[model samples]
Target: MTEVQTLEAPSARRPSASKAPRTTKSTANLGEGFAARVLSVLSEHQRIALRLRHGEGLSPEQVAARMKLPQGVTDRLLADAERTLQAARRAFVEALVENAASRD
Candidate 1:
């Protein structure tokens, strides 16, 4: 007879302290700075979408109803805002890297 083995799911297992993710002061600061920059550069529609979804903790359907826009349009607006923020973050990080390189 052949021996049978079973494997546990990853989520069912507990991670060791050393394997846990760490959030340092610098990492937190970087996240805050990135968010601030993204907000500053967002278009009016993007700003509204972010504010409704995050600031007020509203669902996308609720945001659409509040904005009096179609659900599809609201979804597009949210997606666009996310894309814009990601692009801004990339640019901000690149600028920081370039500045550091220049100083070296």
Candidate 2:
């Protein structure tokens, strides 16, 4: 009768992309947090609208001329920016809820 001996071998594990850590440069925040991330992903027109109207406090007419956008279009752009920010806020809240749930 022959006796068989079992040998243990080390298991090789590969690191997952999801498990990789993000560097600071790749994950810079323009605003406070996730809310900022959502808000920052705006179209050029939307960003210009925000910069002119809020950042520089420019008049509608001036902003329209400087940005080469119609006055009515600039108004719409401002409204769009507001809408984008509100939507971003909702998304941020949802993300927080999801993250919290995952932790639990």
Candidate 3:
């Protein structure tokens, strides 16, 4: 007699599909206004970067060392933060446009 090996599907380890779909949709919506909110929320990091680059007059490499982040990673994070802020601003503008269009 041979014993059969049972394999679990990947889906079994994940959340229920029914909930995941809705969560994904909400995440997309959150991403729409996420940048601006993130900027407002993480103002301290921005301040640190500003201080390092302007106030202390440190280069990105120096800033990365001081911040204890990898130089390339720090650069990417800063750029992403800026882009996220821009995305949030764009989302806000788009919302205002939709609201105005609805009024008309």
* Candidate 3 deviant stretches above 4 angstroms: 1-36, 40-47, 50-59
Per-residue alpha-carbon lDDT of model 1 for 52-97, expressed as tens digits?
8877888999999999999999999889887776677678768766
Query: What does candidate 3's lDDT look like per residue over 1-104, in tens digits?
Result: 11113578867775677744343465567655554355466557665764576567788888899999888877876676556555656776596558557966
Q: Which numbered prediction scores highest in TM-score against the true structure? A: 1
User: Which sections of candidate 1 miss by over 4 Å?
Assistant: 1-41
Query: Over the full model, what C-alpha lDDT does candidate 2 score relative to the true structure?
Result: 0.68
Candidate 2, residues 2-57, lDDT tens digits: the string is 11134556685656889644435423452256545655677778887778877787
* Candidate 2 residue pairs in backbone clash: none
Where is model 2 more than 4 Å wrong at Cα?
1-40, 101-104
lDDT of predicted model 1: 0.75
The lDDT for every candidate, in the order shown, is 0.75, 0.68, 0.62
Q: What are the models' TM-scores?
A: 0.60, 0.54, 0.43
Q: Rank the models by TM-score, top first.
A: 1, 2, 3
